[model samples]
Target: MKKTITAALAVFGLVAFAQAEGDVARGEALSVTCSACHGTDGNSADAANPKLAGQNARYTFEQLLAFQTGDRVNAVMSGFAAPLSEQDMWDLAAFYEAQTGTVGEADAELVALGERIYRGGIVESGVAACIACHGPNGNGNAPAGFPRVSGQHAAYTAAQLYAFREGYRAAEPAADARMTDGESMMMRSVAYKMRDFEIEAVAAYIQGLH
Candidate 1:
C-alpha cells in the first residue's frame, strides 16, 4: 500500500494525482459534508478550522492524498479523505481554490511583532522571510504549490505551525534523501525554528492579511 501511494505521489499521475485540475461545479456539489466546518464557499467560520478558499489546487490535492494514504494523521480529515477518488480530490481542490478567502480579525497585540517576523524573519535564528515564497500579499506561489496564507484562520495556522514544530505533521518521503522534500521540509524547518510567541504572532498577522 505504501509502495502504491509512493508511486502515485512520485508521478502525480495516478488516482488523486492523475487529475491535476478538476471541475469546480462537481467540487461544489461534493462539498456538502465540508460545509459544517468550512462554509459553503470554502471560507471557514471557526478559527480552529482552516479556510480553504483561494488555496492552491495542487497543494490542496496533495494534502488530500496525504490524508487518504494515512501519511497525514488527522482523524476528521482522514475519514473524509479516505473514500475520495482522484477526480473527487481534484474537484474539491478546484472548488476551494475558486472561492474567495474570508479575512479574520487579527490580534492587535501581536500584529506588529508578527509583521516583523513574517516580513523580515528572526535573522539570527536563521528563519527566512515568509514573503520570499508566500509573496508580499501572502497569496502564495501557485505553480510552486505554496498555499495561500492570506486571510486564513489564525488558530488553524498556529495549530499547523505547532504541529510542524513538534513533528506532528507527516514527513514526506524523499526518493533521494539528499533532495529536500521541498514543501514539507521547508515548512518543518521554518516552524521548528520559530519561538511559540513568533508562531502565534505570525499566525495572527496572516489571519488578517489581504
Candidate 2:
C-alpha cells in the first residue's frame, strides 16, 4: 500500500509539471504563426489589425474560440482560428499576454479632449466613462475580460467602435450574458452619442496609452 501510494504521488507530480511546461512550450510555438498580424510581441504593424499585447488571457482566449466556432466573424481570423484546439487558444493567449505593448503618440488637443471624455462621461448624452471598466491607464482588467485598450492603433479603435455601434459585430453567445448585456448597451449608447471627431479624439488618446 505504501509503495503504491508513493508511485501515485510521483505520477501526479509529473502530470502537474507537464501541464505547466505545455503551456509555455505551446505558447512559444503558436506565437510564430501569430507574428505576421500581431507582430513579434503582439503589437500589430498593420493599422487594420488591433494590437493584442497585454490583453487579458481570458479575453484573448474567448475571442479565439469565437473565431474558431464562427460566433465572431472575421474573414481573416476565422480561417486562422478554425484549426486551433482549445489548448492552442490558451497557449496563444498566454504568449500574447506575456508581451509588452508599444505606445503611439497622439495630438495634444485630441488627447486632452479624449482624456475628459474617457474619465467623465457626457451625463446628458448617457455616455459612460471609458475608464470605468478599461481602467485609468486603459490597462484593462483580466478578471473582467476587458482587453487592454492602451497602445492600440487609433484607426483600428475607431473602426471597431463604429462597427459595434452599427451592429456589424454580434455579441458572442458564450460571453457572460449578464456582463454582455450591460456592455453591449453601454457601447451602443456611447457610439451613438459620439461624433466622428469625438471618436477620433478618443482613439488618439487610447493610442498614446502606455
Best by lDDT: 1
Highest-scoring model, TM-score: 1
- RMSD of candidates 1 onward, in order: 6.7, 9.0
* Model 1, residue 171: C-alpha shift (Å): 8.0
Residue-wise lDDT of candidate 1 within 68-172, one digit each (tens)? 775566779889999999888888888888889888778999999999988999899999888888998999986766789999888888888877765525444
Q: Candidate 2's residue-wise lDDT over 1-210, tens digit each? A: 000101111111112211211164567678898889888888999988889887876667767766776555677888999998867777777777777888999878799988888889667777789999899999987665667899899989888777656542444432212112233455656776778888888888999976
Per-model TM-score versus the true fold? 0.85, 0.80
List per-prediction Cα lDDT, in the order shown: 0.78, 0.70
- Against the true structure, candidate 1 reaches a TM-score of 0.85
The segments of candidate 2 whose C-alpha lies over 4 angstroms from its true place after superposition are 1-22, 168-184
